[model samples]
Target chain A: MTDPVAQPETAIIVLGCPEVPVQQALALYVASGLRERGTDVLVTGNPSVLGLLKVSDPKSVYIGKTLVLETCIGEIVERKRDCTLCIVFAHNDAGIAYAATMCHLLPKSRVVVVVFGKDPEPLAAEINFPCETITEKAVHNPAQLKTKITRVLGWAVSRT
Target chain B: MGCIENLKYEKILPLGASFKECREYVEKNYPEVWYVEPGYKLFDEYIIGLPPIALGIENGEKITFPYTKPCHGTYLLRIEGKEEVERVRKTAKTKKQAGYR
Candidate 1:
């Protein structure tokens, strides 16, 4: 008998508040990288952030599935949703809380916290849980974050 | 008794408890309550504030959430009653309105 086709691994990219200028760009970059690696990507965020992403990727090039932040959390809490990888883009206390919650809920999934903002060190320090973390002080320029993301995802840094 | 400042009975988790701790506490103590996180859309508005997590009990009429003040700490507050719950729900957008499939 022929074996059934296996589903592709899934990765969830949870975004924080959109006030930070680099979050959207980095989120797209990470999603694209994950997709290129044969993993399905779902991006979750607030209305403002989702709206920005929607307008930015009108053709659904980078982001595949999009879910509201609360809905995604609720699904995770209820065990209705699961993924192979979870990446949280954090720049504030709330982002840390979200990442911690993800860690607690998805014990089996690999969780990575990407910390950025005016002061990422302090914000990254607030994470007391066990998870991979990448911190870089960035706002308008996403190069630092991009490099860190490439390293975390095992993608080669683009020369261009 | 005149309208004076006073205290009321409520369950408060330990100070400096993280959102994960608070969620676990509520889930263990009040398993029947609905777990809610930040950015949850109520009626027309979203739950956006400090601490970023909450519990809904009594069919969501009472919302137990963490409130943090600068230099103070995080405290769990339960607001009971249909009026208040309805107020928050009305301000939040529903899943349909939020374009959730």
Candidate 2:
């Protein structure tokens, strides 16, 4: 018999450090892909990031349930929410910190770190969590990130 | 009360050994702060073009961590009166202790 409480099959796309334009586009791109696969998609970020996405996808067509950055972290860490996949987008020092914090918060969830911009390997290494790392050189180009985002989501899907 | 509405804006990137230190400094210095979730500053800065997006402190000290263009990085915006600026600055510097860093 299956357990009465069902594990949350949530696919969280944690986005921060929107220094690069691709960061916003890539986030929406990934969310759309996840939704297509029938996965519960949750996009977590600050008001600034969420506002942009809201304007871009005003109808919430591609974007799913949006959570404030702290609330999302709190829910995941407190075990109030169960997640199967976690993806963090890191562009700078602070972005890495956010990613590391998420990794620490959701230990059981499969975490993936996507490092963009120049010289991402070192930044990715600082995550300090067991996560799959994907680095992209095209920080300004959203198209390139699209391909990579697809590959990453595909990977997340397979693992789940 | 009127002074709160006329506060000047100052942006800071808190330098602390840990995130907790940074948080504590903001809390002590600014009387009112609202923390926006970590990953959402971009929208408030770019799309909304507004203040008080996700502030650490609110009211007299309208502290918001909104993103700027080109990813200059997240900054703490202190919206306080002119007289309070120096006091806040002094507190911000003093909070970073030898061990905290």
Candidate 3:
């Protein structure tokens, strides 16, 4: 018998920093949306963000695979894993660097950078990649981030 | 980092392009640059500053430390030299690979 075709995977690199609630919410929200679309989602993040995700999504309904920041890079650089979609949450300069690095490693992946906070345009510009971007000032409000994520995901769904 | 304190260190601001390019730029000019991967736990704690680049320096006698920032648009500790530049690329690569943090 012939083997079944494997589902294309989607990787979300939820770049987070200390004291960023909006970023955490957005990451989870986007991951959940991607999961609903029948995409195999891999959520990569730091300890604090992962911890919050675990508490928020204890059932693993939204996020089934949680990887450390290193493993994510290893997947692309070492194992040569490619993704149908790669989302990067960039709120600060460091976040932008991480986004750039991922884009650099996975040249074939469709990478998108999400930016939020005061005057996000400047930061968005810093990403220095030719990919889709979502920028907003939703630092204080998780709801806004959720809305933005939904809209972005809607666009992504239509594209595929 | 604390482990390589015995060597002189410097910061290579704005790694720009890919890690390979950054490394090549530094090595072609500065032949003394070597890389030291930071432990995972240590890396995780430090990258919170969001530093674009950092590096350790060894001037044949003493080694400097590696450091990073959590934010942007601030005064970076001024550093110079090819070794410093290489250090920045190595540090950024390690952090990018989750080898540092």
Per-prediction DockQ comes to 0.07, 0.09, 0.13
- Model number with the top lDDT: 1
Determine the TM-score of chain B of model 3. Answer: 0.30
Q: After aligning candidate 1 to the native by TM-score, how far in Å is the CA of A41 from where it should be?
A: 0.6
Q: iRMS values in order, in angstroms?
A: 9.2, 10.4, 8.0
Model 3 clash tally?
A: 18
Ranking by TM-score: 1, 3, 2
Worst 10 residues of 3 chain A by lDDT: A1-10
TM-score of each: 0.64, 0.59, 0.62
Best by DockQ: 3
Q: On residues A12-121, what C-alpha lDDT tens digit does candidate 3 reach at each position? A: 65565646568777777777767876788888876767877889889998777887765566556554566877888777665665676666666787777888776678
- DockQ leaderboard ranking: 3, 2, 1
Q: What would the per-residue lDDT of candidate 1 be over residues A53-159, giving only the tens digit for each residue?
A: 99999999888789987677767766789898899988876677677778877789888999998999977888777789999999999998898777666665332
lDDT of each: 0.69, 0.59, 0.56
How do these models rank on lDDT, best leading? Answer: 1, 2, 3
lDDT of 2 by residue, B7-91 (tens): 4556565422233334555555554444433323221222111211233434543444433321333445455443343333343
